[model samples]
Target chain A: MDSTVTTATNESVWGGGNQPLGASYGKLMMWFFLVSDALTFSGFLASYGFSRFKFIETWPIAELVFTHVPFFHGDYPLYYVAFMTFILIMSSVTMVLAVDAGHKMQQTRVIWYLFLTIIGGAIFVGSQAWEWSTFIRGDYGALETKGGRILQFVKADTGERAALADFAKNIPSEREDLQRDKGLWFQSEGYLTSRSVDEVVEGFVANPNILIRTETINDDNHKTVLTREESLKRIKDAAHVVEGANLIHNEYGSRLFADFFFFITGFHGFHVFSGVMINIIIFFNVILGTYERRGHYEMVEKIGLYWHFVDLVWVFVFTFFYLV
Target chain B: MAHAHKLEIFRGLLKFKTNVQKIWAVLVFLTIVTTIEVALGIIKPQALTHSHFLGMKVLNWIFITLTLVKAYYIAWDFMHLRDEKNSLRRAIVWTPIFLVLYLIFILLFEADYIYNVFKFGFVKWNF
Candidate 1:
C-alpha cells in the first residue's frame, strides 16, 4: 500500500497535521530548518577547508594560533579551546536532561536543567568573544614581504618566538591623525602602525639574535627560518610592518587564516547566542506552567532539538577549525 | 505526544535506572571522545600526523570520525530522532545529505584546481 495515498482526507503527507510521520508539526519544521542551517554551515566550513588546503604550506598551524588560555599568558596551546568545547557539549547534555524531564511532566527538574543549559551556553559565547579579541590583537608581529609573504621573528639561540615590542626600535616620529576636520578625511586610513618598515628593518639589522621565519612550512611542520644573512636580506625586502590581524594584514601567516577564523567562528558564536535566547523563552514558558496546561511538554523537546543541533554543529566546527 | 521511543542508548549496552541515567550515559561518551581528541591534538604523535590516509593525515581522520560519532549520539538519543517514524527521519536526514554532499564535492574540487593554478600558473606564489 502506498503511504502517500491518504484517500480519506484532502491533506496529503506533505500537508501539516496533528502528527506527520508520528512527529508533531513544529518538531518537523525545526528539523527542516536545522537541515538547511547545516548546509549553510557546511558551505562555510568547506570554503575554509579549501583555503587551508590551498595554502597548506603557509597556513598557520592551529596549535600555534590558539595557544592562549584565560588568566594564564604563556603558550598554553588548545587548553582554553578545549574547555570551551567541553562546556558546549556539557550544555547539550543538560538540554537533553531538560527534555527528558519534560517527557515525565516534571516541571521543577525541567527548570533546573534548562537553567544549567543557559549558563553553559552563556559561558561558551563569552569565551569565544574573548578568543576573537586575543586573535585580533595578535602576539608577536611580522613583516610582510614585497611578494606578500609574512616573515616572523624568532630567537636565534632558542628558536622561540620574539615579540615585535621586544626588538622593534621606537624611532621618534610625529604623524598627524586625520580627522573629519582634516582635508580628505574620508580617505584617511586608521591609526598608523607603531613602527614603519624602515624602523623595523633598522631594528632587525641592530639585533643579531632575531631570525626571520618564512611562512613556508618545512618537512618538520614548522616555519622555515632563514640564516642570519638571509634574514637580513628578507627584512630589507619588507614592504609593510604588520602588527596584528585586520581584514588587510595578518602577522600570524596567511591573511585568509584570519578571515576564515572570524567568519566561521563568528557564525557558530551567533548560533550559540540564539540558542541561549530560545532556551530562555522556553524556560519561562516551563515556569509559567504553559506546557502543564497543554498536557504535554513538547515545546521543550522541540527547542531541545535546536539546542542539540547547535552542539552538533560545534562538534564539526571544533574539529575542522581547531583540531584538523 | 503519541511518539516516544524506548529510552535507551547504545542498544541498551548498559541498562539505566531511568531516562536521566541514559542522558548521563550519552554525556559521558561525548566527554570521553572530546578528551581523546584534545589529547591527540596536544600530543600530535608524529607517526599519525606525517602519514596521509585518503588525502588527509590519519590524526585528522580520527578527529573527523570522533566528531561524527558525537553528532550521531546527540541526534539519535538527545534529540530523540530514534523515536520518530522512519518516514520523518528520512525526510529530515536524507534531504540535506544529498544537497550538502553535492555542494561540498564541487566546491572542494574547484578549490583544488585553484590551488594548482596558484602553484604552477602565473599567480605569484606569495600572493
Candidate 2:
C-alpha cells in the first residue's frame, strides 16, 4: 500500500497523515498513552474515593498518617509531602527547560536540564520508598476489634495519642515460640505482634490515663474518644493486636485506605522509576550526538512530555489522597 | 533552531523576555499555589473545617479547587499546551475530562448508597 500510487496527500485527514491535529505522530501517540494512563489512575482513585466515602467516618486522616519528616519526627504533618510535591513541580520546571533548549537546538542546555530532572525523579522515588516502609511499620499500634475496627489509645488527661509500647503489659506467660521441631507439620505462624491481645487489654485496664479512641469521627470532625468504662468494654472484644499495616489489616483505621495508598502510590512510584531510566538513556543519547545527527531533538521532547505527565498525576494524587 | 514561540503565560497576562525567565515565572506561580495548599491544610481554620458544603468539608472543596488550578498551569505552561495548535490541544485534553468525571461521579454515588446500607441495615457500623 505504501509503494502504490497514493490519491491523498500528506496533509489530507485520512491519508495516514502525520499532522492532522498539527502534532507529530510520536507526540500524538504519547498524548494518547497519557490519556489512557490518566484514566487508569482515575479508576484507582475513584475506588479509593468510594471506600473513603463509604467509611467516611472511619477513614484514616492524612494529617495524622503522613506526619513524619525525614530527620525530624515530631508531629510535622504534611511537611514532607509538601516537600515531595515541591520537588516534583520543580522537576517539571526543569523538564520544560529541557524542551525549550531542544527547540532551540541547544544541546548542552538540554543535557544539563535533563540531568537535573533525572535527579529530581530519583529523589522522589527514594522518598516514596521510605514512606512505604514507614507506613508498613506503623508507629502507634492498635487493637483490631472483631468487627474490623481499630482502637487506638490516647491520654485521657492530655488528649495526646499514645503508643502500644508505652502501655502494653510485659507478660511472661507460657507462650512458646513455635519452631520447626515444635510444629506438627512444620507450618509456622507469621510474624508475631510484640504485644498480644491479652497483654494489651491487661495493660489498658491497669493504666488509668490511657483511653480508647475509636476510628469513628464525631460531629467535631475528630475521632470519638470513649469514656473510661467504655474503653474497658471495647477492649474485651479485641480479636487481635495489630502492629502495622499489611494488605489485610491496618493499625491506623480502614484496611482499604492502606490498600489504595499502596496501589496508587506504588503505581505512581513505578512510573517515576521508569521515567528516570528513560531520561538517563535519552541523556546519554544526547551526549553521544544521536539526536544531533538525526537532525531533531524530538526524543528529548517526547520524554519531557512523559515527565510532565508524571508531575500532573501527582497533583491529583496529592489533592485527593492527602488533602481531600 | 531560532523559532520558538514568544515567552508569555496566562494568555499574555505575564510576559517574559527569555525562555529561562518564563520557566522561573511558572515555577514561582506553582510554588505559591502549593504553599497556599500546604498552609490551608496545616492551619485548617475552624470555619472551613466545621462547615459542610456539598456533603463534604468546605476546606476540602478549597483544596480540590486549588489543586485543579495547579494542574491547569502545569499542563498549560510547563507542558507547553498553550503553544500547541487548537486541534492538538483539544485532542489531548478533552478525551480524559469527560471519562474521568463520569467514572468518579458514578462510583462516589454508589459509595454513598453502600454507606447507608452499612449504617442502617443489618450490617453493623463497625467490625
Candidate 3:
C-alpha cells in the first residue's frame, strides 16, 4: 500500500495521483504558509493606509521625518533607508545563489552564499534598530495641544526647524519626576521632558525670530506657519512639551503615524531576526555535510524561500512607508 | 536532480544563458527600479505631484507600478516560482493577489468615506 501510494502512475492528475501539482508536501505547505503570511502583512499595511487617509490633511511627510543618517547629518533624506533596501536585496540575491548551489550539490558554495546572506540580514536588522532609536529620540521637540495636535517650531528668518534646546530659557523651577519608590504605589509616571511648557512659551516670546508651524498642511503642501501674534496665541493652548514619539504622543505629527511606524516596522524587523537565526542553523548544517549525507539540499531551498519572503515584504514596507 | 529554470524575463524579450546569470540579471533589474523609486521620491517633480491620476498623485502611481514590477521579478525569479508547475504557481500567486486587491479596495473606499465625514460633518476632527 505504501509503495502504491509512493509510485507515480500514469493516471490523470485530477485522480489525486502522487504529487499532482509536482511539489513535495513540505514545499507546498511552505507556499501556503507564505501566502497566508503575505495576507497578514497586507492587513497591517492597509490599516496603516486607513489611518493615513483618516489623517490626510495633517499626515507627516516621510521625507522630513526620516532625514537623519548615522554619523554625518545635515538633512539627507531617504539615503539611509535606500541603503537598507539595497542590503536586503543583496541578501535576497545571496540566498537565491545559495539555493542554486544547493541544487548542484555544491556544499562549499552553499556555505559561502549562506554566510554572505546572514551577514547581509544582520546589517539590515541592525540598521532598523538604529532607525527606531533615532525615531524614539526625536531631533526637535514640539508642543502638544489640548486637542492632541503637535506644534513644531521654526526659525522665522531661515524657515529651518528649531530645536527646543536652541531657544528654551534656563528658567529656575522645581520639577520632580514621579517614582514608584518616592510616590504613590499605584501612581507612577514616565520621565519628565527636558523643558517645561512654560519655559518653551517664554523662550518663544523672547525670541522674535521664532514661528509656530502647525500640523495642518496648507494648499502649498507645507505645514501652515502662523504669524507672530497667532504663534503667541497658539502657544497658550499647548498643554505639554512632547519630546519624542510613543504610543500616545508623537513629535512628528499624528499619534497614529508613530503607532503604525513602530508596529509595522517592528514586526518586519522581527521577521528578519528570525530569518537570520534560521539561516545560521542552515549554515551550520551545510558546514557539517548534513545535506551531503541526506543526498539533497532541499533544506537550503526551503529556508531560501523563507528568506526571500522576508525581502519581498521589505520591498512593500519600504515603498509604502518611505516612498509613497 | 537539478531542474531547468525558465531563463527569460520580460515575457521572453530578454534571456539569460544560465540560472546564475538570470539571477544576476533580475538583481540588476531590481536595483535599477529601486534607484528610480528613490530618485523620484527625492526629486518629486512638480508636474507629477500636481497631476492626479485615479485619485492619486502621478508620482505615487509610478511608485506603486514600479513596486509591483519589482515584486514580480522577486517572486518569479528569486523565489523560483517560474520553475514551479503552473498549478503550483497559480495556487501560490493568484490567491493572495485576488484577496489582497479586494481587501485594499474595500478598506481604502471606507477610509475615504470616513475622511469626508470628519472633514465636512458636524463632528469635529481629533475629537
True contacts kept of 2: 0.79
DockQ of each: 0.66, 0.58, 0.59
lDDT of candidate 2 over A128-214, digit per residue (tens) = 998999999999999998988899999998999999888989898876777877768868877889888988898899999999999
Per-residue alpha-carbon lDDT of candidate 1 for residues B19-49, written as tens digits (9 for 90 to 100): 6777888888988999999999999999998
Model 3 pairs in collision: none
Ranking by lDDT: 3, 2, 1
**Mind giving the per-residue lDDT tens digits that candidate 3 earns over A1-324?**
322233465656565536756777777788889999999999999999988887788999999899999999789999999999999999999999999999999999999999999999999999999999999999999999999999999999999999999999989987576768986788878668999998998999999999999988887668899999999888888899998888999999999999999999999999999999999999999999999999989889898899999999999999999999
Clashing pairs in 2: A147-B127, A148-B127
- Model 1: pairs clashing at backbone N, Cα or C within 3 Å: none
lDDT of 3 by residue, B1-127 (tens): 2288889999999988899999998999999999999999999898998889988889999999999999999999999888887777887889999999998999888889989998889877552
TM-score of chain A of 2: 0.94
- List the lowest-lDDT window of 10 residues for candidate 1 chain A: A1-10
Give lDDT per model, in order: 0.85, 0.87, 0.90
Q: Per-candidate TM vs. native? A: 0.94, 0.94, 0.95
Per-residue lDDT tens digits for candidate 1, residues A1-324, read 214333345556565454536666787788889998998998899888878878777888888888899888698888898899899889988998888888888999999999999999999999999999998888888889888789999999999998877788878877776667777746765757777887788888999999999988898877899999999876777898888797778888898888888898999899999999999999999999999999999999888889989988988988988898
- Model 3's DockQ? 0.59
Order candidates by DockQ, high to low.
1, 3, 2
Residue A172's C-alpha lDDT in candidate 3? 97
**Error in Å for residue A153 of model 2:** 0.3
The predicted structure with the larger lDDT, 1 or 2, is 2
